[model samples]
Target: MTRGERALLISVDAGSSVPPYEQLRGQLAEMIGDGRLPVGTRLPTVRQLAADLNLAANTVARAYRELESAGLLQTRGRHGTFVAPGRDDAMDRLHRVATDYAAEARRLGVPPAAALALVRAALDATRPG
Candidate 1:
C-alpha cells in the first residue's frame, strides 16, 4: 500500500490528553513496528502529512525527527523520508523491547547517557566472540 494510504489509517483526537505529535509518532511507530510499513517504505513528506492531518508542519516534523532519532526512519535529502531497513521481526522485537527498557530507565531517573551505556554493556556482554 502507498504511504498516504497507510497514513490515512491514523487519526488524531485533539481532545485527548496525549499531544498530537506524540499520537502521530506512536501511530507511525506502531505501523513501522508491524509489517504494515516494511523496510524501505517511503513516508509522506512532513508538509503533506501535516496537511492531511490538519496539523501544523512543525508537529509532523517533530514526530518525524523523533522517529529518525530512534533509527526507525531516515531522511534522504530531496528524496524524502523512508522507513529504515531492518531485520524484520527480529528488529521489530528489539525495537519494542528497547523502547520498554528506555521507558523503565526514564521512570527510574536514569540519565540518557547512562541508560545507553548500560544497554551497550548488555549488548557487548551478549555478543558472541
Candidate 2:
C-alpha cells in the first residue's frame, strides 16, 4: 500500500483500546521515527483525519496538538500539519521492544509473517478475555 493509504488505515483503527488521540500520537511518532512519513511530509488536516477516521474533529485536533507539543509534528499557519524533524525518545523504547521481539523470534525460528501475526493477535486480544 502507498504510505498515505496505510496511514489512513491506521487512523481508522483509532477506536481501539488506546484512546484515539494516543493511538494517533503513537502511530505518527513511529512513522516519523521510521522515516515512513518523512520530515516535512504534510499530514491530513484535523478535519480530514476526523472525517476519514469517523472521529470528532476535536479529537483529531487534540492528538495533533499533543504531537505538536511533543515536537513530532508542526503546524504552519494555513499550510497544515507536517512531520517534525528529530528523534523522540519514544523511538528508543520502540527499538528496544523490537529488538527483544526479534531476538525471541530468532530463537524460536518464528517466521517474520508469523511473528507479525502474533503481534496483531495480541493487539486484538487486549480486551477483557
Candidate 3:
C-alpha cells in the first residue's frame, strides 16, 4: 500500500438492493472520478479488500477485474493495482453501455422477468451489475 493509504473498509448498506460487489465497484469508481483516489493511486490487494469488508477474495477480485477490464484500473504483477489514467470517464460510459444493453434486451422480446433473470445470471456469473 502507498504511504498514507488508509485502508478503509468501505461501508455497505445492508438494506440496499445493490450487491456488495457493485457497492465496492461503484464506490471505487466514484472515488476515482471525484479524485478521492487519484490517478495512479495504488489500491489494496484483493485479499486485503476482502478481509477489510469480511468478503470473499473472489468477490473483490471480480470487482477489480471488471474495473480493470473497463480501463478504470491496471494491475501490476506482484506490485498491486493502481488507478488507470483517464478512467474517470468510464463510469458514465459504463452506465450508457448498461442502458444500451437493457434496451437491446427489451427489443429482443425478452420479458421483464426473463430480462432480470438474465441480469441476475450475468451478475452471478461475473462481477456485480
The models' CA-based lDDT, in order, is 0.83, 0.73, 0.75
* lDDT (10s digit) by residue, model 3, range 1-129: 577365554786666555778778867866665567777788888998888888889889988998898777898889888888765466756655665665576578776578779888978899856
Task: Give candidate 2's error at residue 54 in angstroms.
Answer: 0.5
**TM-score of every candidate relative to the true structure:** 0.68, 0.59, 0.64
Between which residue pairs do clashes occur in model 3?
none
lDDT (Cα, 0-100) at 42 in candidate 3? 85
**Which regions of candidate 1 are displaced past 4 Å?**
1-7, 87-91, 97-129
lDDT (tens digit, per residue) of candidate 1 on 24-127: 99778877886688778889889998988999999999999999988899999998899887556777898778767866876798876898899899889999
Residue range with the least summed lDDT across 10 consecutive positions in model 3: 1-10
Q: Per-residue lDDT for 1-129 in model 2, tens only?
A: 224333544654644444777667666766766668777788888888888778899988998898788677889989778877775668647754865685588578887678889988988999687
Residue pairs with colliding backbones in model 2 are none
Q: Cα lDDT for residue 43, model 2?
A: 87
Candidate ranking (lDDT, best to worst)? 1, 3, 2
Question: Alpha carbon lDDT of residue 126, candidate 3?
Answer: 96
Off by over 4 Å in 2: 1-7, 12-15, 86-129
